[model samples]
Target: MRVLVVEDHAFFLLGLVTALTGHGHEVVTAGEPYQAEKLLGERRPDVAVVDIKLPPTHSDEGLRLAALLRSHEVPVLVLSQYAVPEYAISLLGADPRGRGYLLKERVAGVAQFMGALDRVAAGGTVIDTELAAMVTRAAARRAVLSPLSERELEILALVTEGLTDRGIAERLVISVHTVVTHVQSVFRKLDLPKTPADNRRVLAALAYLRNG
Candidate 1:
């Protein structure tokens, strides 16, 4: 696979490039947004690993670059130091496919970072569980989610982590039936429109995370 890494930090870029090369991936790099856009104009990589805060502004430049990469048909995985849910929401936008937001600490575990990149490359959503929680906690008392009780919010967070009813029940040490009850209430409070897909749980969680 061809991977594009857009990051301003030199040492981290060195380590990441070495890792991707060791894993048999071809790599292209850009230290900042302008250079990244120039590379994008020349060639689109299979996937892009971008930092949220980039040089010059050291703010959302990398994030905006990720969006541009996606516009160019390259999948993007945002690797950042901060767990800002709002950033994740903006990065995800309306379409979650081929988009991912993972905290930079995951890079310490090479396997985790690669796994997330692989998923994004395959056009899947990869929201970090920690970010999932921050997304909800940050939105607490905001619209849609304001009606949820504490337990419902907890269950919603677990849902965003990709846990099933049974999995959530096991982790929370509650009966599956109890977990289902909480989950049902969560969706009801959010008032999600009925859809044929079984991903209503995910939609409900995303709704809450984006609302508050």
Candidate 2:
């Protein structure tokens, strides 16, 4: 797999490049803001792993860049220093496929990090369980996620991990039909409207993570 890494920190960038290359992936790198754009124009990578902090107004530059890349239908996996639910909401926007938002600390878990990158590149949505816990807590505080049953919440968490219906069913040792029933119940309880893109699962999970 080919990956483009956009990170300003040299040490961390080197670590990422080294780790990804060692994982048998072709890695392209850019250390400066906007350099990723140039590389994107030059070569198409399966996925772009970006850091949320960058030079020249080090605030949300990477987030902005991720959004831009999504507009071109590119897959993006964003790494953030904090588990900010709002940031995840903003990054995912309407279309949640081919997107991911994970905590920067998770980079230490090489297997987990690589799995997330592969999932996003394959057109799946993956948010860190830690980040999702943060959002779930926030939503609970606001009483926005109270309507979901314990089982529904469990399924939502799995969905947030980018599991498909069959995967979720297998994980829970339940039938696919049961998983679908629970999923539909979740959407109804959340009042998530269906869209032509068939992204209701992502939308419902996003709503839970975003606190309604």
Candidate 3:
């Protein structure tokens, strides 16, 4: 796989490039958004790993670039030191396919980062679980979130982590029936629309994260 990395921090960039190369991926490096844009025009990569902040403006240049590239069917995985909910919402927009938002700390694990890159590159969403919890907590005051019990909130967080019903049950040491009940409650309380063709669990989580 070919990947374009856009990050201004030298140390992080070096480590990321090394890790990706070691994992058998071809890497193209750029230090800033402009250079990244130039590279994008010149060569199309399988995926773009971008930092949420960049040089010159250092304020959402990576996100702007991600949004721009997505229009052309480019997959992007954005990393940030902090999980800015607004940026996550905007980067994801309506189409969550081929996009991901991860905390910078997650990059420390080469396997984890590579797995996320592979998923996003294949048109899947991979949001950081901690970030999803952060967004959920911030919106705790909202009425839509108020109806959910603490157990329901826990289940919702697991759902956002891309856990299956059985997975959530195993993690929580509960029955699959219990997990199903909580999931149903979460959807009902959150007023998540029913869409059989879509990944409604993820959509519900995104909606809560965005609105909250």
Stretches > 4 Å off in candidate 1: 137-155, 161-189, 195-204, 210-212
lDDT of each: 0.78, 0.81, 0.81
Candidate structures ordered by TM-score, highest first: 2, 3, 1
Angstrom error at residue 127, model 3:
1.8
Worst 10 residues of 2 by lDDT: 194-203
For candidate 2, lDDT tens digit of each residue in 93-166? 87788989888878889997898788789888887787766666677678887998889888877776667787
Residue 159, model 2, lDDT: 71
Residues 1-212 of candidate 1 have per-residue lDDT tens digits of: 99999988999999999999988999999999899889888877999999998988997997788778878989998987887767777887766668788888788789767876786798766677887787777778455467888899898887765455876798899999998878777777777654322234454467556763
Give, for candidate 1, the lowest lDDT window spanning 10 residues.
194-203
Clashing pairs in 1: 139-212
Candidate 1 global CA lDDT score: 0.78
lDDT of 2: 0.81
lDDT of 3 by residue, 6-110 (tens): 999999899999999999999999999889889988989999999999988999998999988897688999999886667777888887778888999898877
Q: Model 1 RMSD to the real structure?
A: 4.0
Q: Which is superior by lDDT, 1 or 2?
A: 2
